[model samples]
Target: MGSDDQGNNDVGRSGFTRRGFIQIMGTGAVSASLAGAAIAARSKPVPPEKVMDAENTVKISLHVNGAQHAVLVESRWTLLYVLREAFGMTGTKEGCSRGECGACTVLIDGIPRYACMTLAVEAEGRRITTLEGLMSGEQLGPVQNAFLEEDAYQCGYCTPGQIMAVEGLLRKNPTPSLDEIRIGVSGNLCRCGAYTHIFRAAQKAADLKKR
Candidate 1:
C-alpha cells in the first residue's frame, strides 16, 4: 500500500485513475448538455409558417385562348415564362424583356400587350391569346393566312407579335384603314424590314376576318 508502483496500479474508487476520471467527467458533461438540448427541442417544437422566397410557387389559373389552365408559377415569373415554360406556348418569343421590343407580344382580353412586360400573376384572370391560338384546329386564322399570302414575315422572328397585334387591332376595328393598320402594329418591330408587306398583310387580314 505504501509502494509507488502499488499506488499507481491500484484499482481506485469507481475503478478509474485520476486522469481517466477527469476524462469520463468531461465526456459525461458533453453528453448531458446534448441530452438537455434534445429534450428542450422535443418539449417545444417549431410551428409552420409561410416563407416568401424565389423557390415559392403560387397556384394560378390562366384562360389562354379558348382553354383553361391551372398551373403553379413562381412569384417573380414573367408572363413570357408562364406562356413558354409553364403552358408550352413558345410562340410568344422573348425579345427585349424590358418591353422595348414587341417580339413577346400577345393578346390579353383582346388587347395587345407585351408578354415580357406583363407578370404571370397579372395575367392569371385574363384571356391570353398567343400565336398558337390563332389556329383553329390546324386551320390558320385569317391573320396568319394573310401574312402567308403577302409574305409579311421575312426571318419570321417578329411574325408572331406582328400577327397578334394585327389580330387585336382587327378585333377592335374589323375594317382598319392602311394608316390604322400601320398605327396598330407600330408597337411591334420587324427587324427584317418587312413593314411594307406586313401592312399589306394586315389589310388583307381585316378583309378576310370581316367575311
Candidate 2:
C-alpha cells in the first residue's frame, strides 16, 4: 500500500506491492472517468415535450352541420382523421388513402373536397359536412333516400361522398336531368358499374325537390 499527495490509500485487499499501487491508481482513474461521464450525461438538457407533442397536437376549428368545434389535433393528421378520430364522424370512407379515390370526400361549405388530402388546419373555420350530418333525426335527407330507393350503391364504398355531391348538385340545379346527373357524379367513380343507378338516384333527388 501507498499514500498519494491526496492522502488517499492506493492499495487493494491483496498484499500492497509496487505493482499493487499501480493497479490501485489505474482502477481509481477508470472509476473517475466513468463518474465524470455519468455526470455529463445527467446534466445534458432533455428535449422539449412540445417537440414530441408536435406529432400529437395542432389547433383546429370547424363548423360542422351548423355546429362549431375547436380541437387540438396531431400535426400529421388529415381532415378525415380529425372528423373520424376526434369528432366520431366516420361516414367518410378511407379508400385508396393516397387520395386517388373520392371515397373520403366531404363538403366544405357546399363544395366537395377530398378529406384525405385536406389538413385538419385547412378545414378551420369552414363548414364541413359528413354523411352522418346529411340526415335529420329520423328522416333521411332527400339525397340519402334517393340513393336508398334507387339502389345507387353496390358495395357502397363511395356512397357518402356520392350522396354529398348529389346534395351539392341539387342545391345548384334543382332539376338536373339524367345527363346532368351523369355529369354531376363524374367525379365519383363506382367500381361496381352502378353509375346508372347512382345517376338515377340524383335525378330522383331532383324530382323530390320539385315536390
Candidate 3:
C-alpha cells in the first residue's frame, strides 16, 4: 500500500510495537507495583516481636499438642528449635530454614505455618501442633495412618511437614478436591516427586475421616 501503511505495519496493529514493548511493560510494572502497595496496605502487620531480632532471652509458656510447656528461649530462636531441641519433638524436619521449603511446617492455631520462620517468643500463648502431636496416646491419628497406608513418603525427610500440612488442609477443608489438594500441598516440596501418592494419602485421609 502507501509508505505510511508500511511503517504502521512494521510497528504493530495495536498497542506498542516490538521495540516499544519494553517501554509498555515498564509502565505496566509501575501500575502493578501501585496495586501491590494498595493490597499490602490493607493486610495486617506481622507481630513486631516477630520482626525484631531475637538477641535477648525470654521465658514463655506454650500450649503444644494439649501439653503445656514453661521454657526459656532466645528471642532469635525459631519455634522449630524449641520444638525439636528443648521439647525434643523431632518429627518436624528442617529443610530450608528460610520458609521456602515446607519441611519445617507446623500447625499454629489450626493454621499451617513454617516453624523456621516463626519466632519462639511470638508463639507464646498459642497452640502449636507438631507432627508428634498427631498421636493419640499410643495410636497414630487418622491423617498419619492414612499417610502410612497410602505410602506418601520416600526418603521421609519431608514426610513430617507434608503430613502436618495435609492435616491442616483436611481440618479446614475436610473433603478437598484433587486440585485443592495439589494447591494445599504446593508449599511443601517433595524432592522425590511423590506428589501423586501424597495426594492419594490426603484423599484417603479425608475418606478415613468420613468413616
lDDT of each: 0.73, 0.67, 0.74
lDDT, residue 169, candidate 1:
95
lDDT of 3 by residue, 1-211 (tens): 1133235433221211222212212222234334334434654434334333446666776667655677888877889999888877777888889999899999987789999999888887566787766764435677877766776776778888999999999999999999999999999998988899999999998987788
> In model 2, which runs have C-alpha deviations exceeding 4 angstroms?
1-56
Model 3 residue 6 lDDT score: 30
TM-score of 1: 0.74
In candidate 3, position 187 carries an lDDT of 93
For model 3, what is the error of residue 175's alpha carbon versus the real structure, in angstroms, after optimal superposition? 0.5
Residue-level lDDT of model 2, residues 1-211, one tens digit each, is 0123113243221212222222212222334434334433654424223332567676555666655667788767889988778776777888877777688878876677789998777666556777766655434577777776777777777888788888878878898887787777777778878888988888888877677
How accurate locally is residue 6 in candidate 2, as Cα lDDT from 0 to 100?
17
TM-score per candidate, chains pooled = 0.74, 0.71, 0.74
Question: Between 1 and 3, whose lDDT is larger?
Answer: 3
Comparing 2 and 3 by TM-score, which wins? 3
Provide backbone clash counts, one per model. Answer: 0, 1, 2
Which order, best to worst by lDDT? 3, 1, 2
Clashes of 1: 0
User: Evaluated with lDDT, which candidate comes out highest?
Assistant: 3
For candidate 1, lDDT tens digit of each residue in 18-91?
Answer: 22112212222234334334433553333233333686887776666655667888868888998888766677
Where's the lowest-lDDT run of ten residues in candidate 3?
A: 12-21
